[model samples]
Target: MATAGKDTTDASGGPGNTATPAIRHSKPPVNHHRAPRAATYSTSILPFERSPNGNILAAFCRAAYWTQGRAVWGALTASGDTKHCYKMDHARRGRAIIINNETFHHDLYLGQRTGTDRDAENMESLLSELGFDITARKNCTAAEMKSMLVEAARESQGDADCFVCVILSHGDDGAVYGTDESVKVEDLVAPIKACKSLAGKPKLFFIQACRGKFVDGGVEVVDSKGKHGQDDEEEMESDEVAVQTIPVEADFLMAYSVAQGYYSWRNREQGSWFVQAVVKVVRDNWRRMDLLTMMTRVSHKVAYDFESNVPSNRFLHMKKQIPCITSMLTKDLYFTPKV
Candidate 1:
């Protein structure tokens, strides 16, 4: 869910031949419990099911939609802040398919004041009611996010199971922000390991954006009780649980919000904060929780519901912003459910 500017073109869009760059070397550490594995660590766990349309699983769209090998793709803000014309709908689940390329916030840059077309229509109605399949391309090109991940890895031909991509643009170190343009997430995830039908699956990339410099503090205040609003569970036991699946050399997971340089928050109005704390902890814990404990309860509610005041500005005023999770998940992915 990270995207900002634009410019790097390829796939006939012209300009340095759509840039592929190639930065593969970096996939060797993930044991994720061996279930058609693929390496990635720091806390990765995706593989949940249930929700064919009713009974419950609606909050964030998840009917499974084909989970055989998993297949999801997102390009979100290729280089557009907003032009708007979205799409996202899913309902299969047997083989896993969720793609909601969200693109909202069309033109402004750095100063942002609300425009990305209602933040790309609320990220296409919140990942299509949490199901995802937003029809693809709200703002694309890195040759269309590498030709839609090589056509969702050739329609997951070789039994595609796991491969997710979520980029919500506006970054720095390494790069991301394409809406007029700015690319390089290693040129759109190094061509998904030369897609042999997504080679060995398990290729997740859930980044939010901002990896530069903007600090006044680290942000880590805690002190809450209940009533004001509740959703407790501050670690009863599960602290670390990355199992590792394919990455003896294949699988991959890249979840980022900050920690390269720093600074990830966008609220010209109401968006950003690691994607509203990752869709409010996956719509209040996808049935119970397990995407690394719902992204560590969205990194502890974005480190205690955010704070970086500087209102009076005597010299700099407010800044503080902390949000980081560089996990490369390998296993222990309960996939959240079981309530």
Candidate 2:
């Protein structure tokens, strides 16, 4: 089994410090949720100029073209092209399970995961709004977690369009902690993958936990606007479709809160940066973007918008994180609003 490591402490204690002998392993804390302060810099371009090239007409035309393109694509996808996208017209959206493990067993030596309830609450709200039937479990042991997941997988999914599992806990590379012990990430998802009823359906796993102990001291870069601005598939069909069997791993999307070998950051009063960004991005853009696209936005929000601010611990201060997405989805996934 993977060993748990020290993480951030509660609001009063410095990061990586435990009041007792047992090791506590949770996300490092960010004292605040706001962006870091930076010195203001002036840009060469005038504030009134809307376009980089200084051509109002050209900028207007480009904007119009992009809007038109998006409309066209939306129309196409809204028509339900099953060949390129998952069919989401089921009577029910899907079943969603959230496993939130906050406090751990004394023998486990893992620290209590502070603020995880916020993450769970946010996730529950988001998924519920998206039409998923939510099943929430808190502070489950490893056996209980495995049993619950297996039972969930076995539940009839014929009426459902997808499956979602969100885990908020302390973790190491490839494993997430239950209250009593660690469970392999793969083991957590294997039962779902083997669910015959959910074959060819999207199975999403959102994991908010540390993958390792490494910290990211983000690199600084000048804004391009200050320096003069600027900035920055496919399907197949077949007749006879001979005994088509989807790969056990197909349609699985695993979103990790942090890159491997790094600590994921969380706010003691709010939630993990990754989960908060996911809730915000999905709520804002799910109607217009595919799951992968929304996840990309989630990664961006977490990477650029959040940073650790543990002034009490120099090693944990100003730390950064980038979410990792592993997708084996065979088609575009859109969470179209329920009628």
| Best model per TM-score | 2
Question: Looking at candidate 1, what is the lDDT of residue 100?
Answer: 23
List pairs with backbone clashes in candidate 2: 24-111, 25-111
Q: Per-residue CA lDDT of candidate 1, range 110-215, in tens?
A: 3221323344445445445433344334344335555566555556444323455666655566666543455666656666766665553456666666666544
Report the Cα lDDT for candidate 2.
0.70
| Worst lDDT 10-window in candidate 2 | 232-241
Off by over 4 Å in 2: 1-7, 10-74, 77-82, 224-248
Q: Pick by lDDT: which candidate is best?
A: 2
Candidate 2 lDDT over 122-236, as tens digits, reads 8988887677888887777777778878988889999899999999988777888776667887788889988999999999999998777678888776641111101100000
TM-score of each: 0.29, 0.72
